[model samples]
Target: MKILAPVSSLSEALPLIESGARELYCGLSPAAWGKEHGDNIWLNRRGPGKANLADLEELEDIVTLAHRKETRVFLTMNQPGYVKAFYPDLVSFVRDTLSIGVDALIMADPGLIKRVKEKEPAAVIHVSSLAAVLNSSSIAFFRSLGAQRIIFPRYLDLRVLRKMIEASEGDLEFEAFVLNDGCVFEEGFCHVSHAFGGAFCHNPAWSYKLREISSGGNKVSQVPAGGESFQQNVDEYKRWLWLGIKNFGGFPGPGGYPLGMCGLCALPELQALGIVSLKIVGREASLRKKAAGVKLVRKTLDLLEAGCSESELRERAGELKGVPGLCRSGYMCYYR
Candidate 1:
């Protein structure tokens, strides 16, 4: 099993490389909200400036360092929107990336897959989970596009996943998220970002301000503004909160930390299945949290590769138990 760690900052990246992370995913800069990073801009709007994906030199450095330790890297281009809006620049990014000889590209956009085929034909593409290939037809579609592997979405049950793989007719590789948090909103697909801005919202800040409207509305909010601050319509946003749903569970609270053992526990099963990669969700993790999680995952993989038995795997997994969030479904098989 290969472990991929999340790199949120440059400071946290080196240790993960040394620890045994096969791949690391991170933004060009240390922006927590994803606004400052150029990639997020494309997510909001597919047009021109979105091509400023990130610092290529920084990515090269990460590639060089990871290569030194015999690890591969994947750059995510998971934006979902019109192809023509960002196709040209996306093509340029791929061209430059292939020139650097990075490992593979993780993507969800169909337009991107088409462009990659036209520009950097040899580049390997890993279908992002956002594409959610639940059926054999979808899987075949990606395979026909020359996708090397597909990252399965997390919502599928184990039985359905196994069935889908069995029914699929291609030789494409499979990747699954074994650990970390996943939003209810599908990555690379949802339009919540667009509600804030027509095409793009770079580092758009959202604010919560109380106000009074002219028509005697008790509580109103400032108009929704771009560039970082998003003020919800006082009445509208509050009505959303009152709705009985888990979607808004963590509206403004500090999010959960890394789960230490989640990645480690899945290694043995993944190895047994000969899976191509073991990815840990690190997009939002801090460098220290990222490092610790990577270390635990690396240590677990090492033991399992040495022919560790199921009993031993359980014990090792227990020893590296991850940090718990505010709420959880309790102990259960990760794949379940």
Candidate 2:
């Protein structure tokens, strides 16, 4: 399996490639996009400025450098869907990126995918996880639309993924999330906009109440509002969310790697199931965090390649992550 790292700037290219990323993916938002649509409207799924490369020039440079190392770079145009009005500009933007030698387009919207394929017949496209391809039929649908690979959505059951791969026809490539950034919901169905400040799920001020339906057909609190037991459960949920989002309270663990939702223990199974790429999912993270992610995955894959037993690999991965408690708890696991 190949390591696919996220790159957001020209400077991130070489180091990530050297760190064991055979493939790189990044988001791009041209200056004209913001000028025309304003900052609130995102050209891609991620926030504009920090998460994306600002111009094609930098992208071209990064592509050229990556190509020299035989590392492929993919550009993300993977919004769930866009307005019809944006198609003309979106198509043109895709054309420009392809002309500059971007290896492929990682996208979600079927209409946009069809449009791009019609315009650039030879352009390679990977269906983004945002497409939420959940079953064999979904895979076939995308294959018909000319997607060469599928980035499976986060939180899918491994058995389901394996069955889908087994049942599917043709030579479609499959990629799975191996590290970082877990979402609380399926991204394809989420309507809340992250283009503003952040996602609704990440709002810290939010609270939850557990209620039961009484025999009288009225609602009754299962636990008293703000009761100690209820408050403890809510606080525990928040901590898990925090660990998922910031990887142990916004800092690297003792092993110098971010400890977020991980699938390191599943690497052996994923490879056995014909998964072609393992994705590390933070394009907006700092350079150090990105590099550390690559290093951690690289080391883990090395152990797998060297014929470590599944149990041995899991133990090693937990040790490398330096959070055995988190590993044991299974809160940060992607495959458990």
Candidate 3:
């Protein structure tokens, strides 16, 4: 399987490629974007900040360098949806990037995809995970729109993933998350703005309460919530959320690797299932973290190629992360 690493700048291109990334994806927001739409509106889902490259020249440089190493570069325009007024400029921006030798456009908005295809029919498009493509019908819909690949969302069950891949019948390429980052809610359904500060789900100040429901189920009563068993379930859910948030503070686990959701152990099955690319998320993360992620996935893929058993691969992956306990607990598993 091809290792697809996230690139945030020209500087990160060579290091990531040298570390075994055969494919690179990044976001771009040109200077004119802020001037035209201001800071409130984001050019992509990541919002206007370090998550995206600030200029096109830098992207061009990164693309040029990546192509030299036989590595493909994909640009993200994967905001779930965008305002109608941004279409004219958005189309132009996409065309410019394609002209700069970007291998494909990673996009989520159907209207944007249609517009891009209309302007540049031969342009390669990878349907973004934010599109929430969970079923075969969604796959067919995107394929009809000239999408060459689909990046599966993080929450899909393994059975569903297998069915979807089989349903494709080798007509389209597939990419799945392999490391870093996780969302509490389905990303496509989340419309909250991050410009205010952080995402609504990631806010640490928020609190949760369990209320007793009336027998008729028409009202919530001001009671002590539930018995010990029910409260234990609630506590466990909270613990899951905390771990999902990387200990609720973005702290790294052992070896300074940013600890979040991971799918290293699923590599063998994904490769056998015809997955074309294994994506390493977190374009906005530190350079160290990004490099470490690529290296970890690279080592895992190498082990797979060496004919390691699934059980051995799982143990090695946990050892590589230095958190076998977390792996055993299923807290960091992407498939689980």
Whole-model lDDT, model 2: 0.90
Q: Is candidate 2 or candidate 3 better by lDDT?
A: 2
TM-score of 2: 0.93
CA lDDT for candidate 3 = 0.86
Model 2: pairs clashing at backbone N, Cα or C within 3 Å? none
Off by over 4 Å in 3: 203-207, 215-228
TM-score-wise, the better of 1 and 3 is 3
Task: Quantify all predictions' global Cα lDDT against the true fold.
Answer: 0.59, 0.90, 0.86
Q: Residues 211-256, candidate 2, lDDT per residue (tens digit)?
A: 6778688767587656479778888778778777556655888989
Q: After superposition, how far is residue 148 of candidate 1 from its true place, in Å?
A: 0.4
TM-score of 3: 0.93
Error of 2 at 167 (Å): 1.3
Candidate 1, residues 250-314, lDDT tens digits: the string is 12222223431143455665555446777776454455556665666666777787888877876
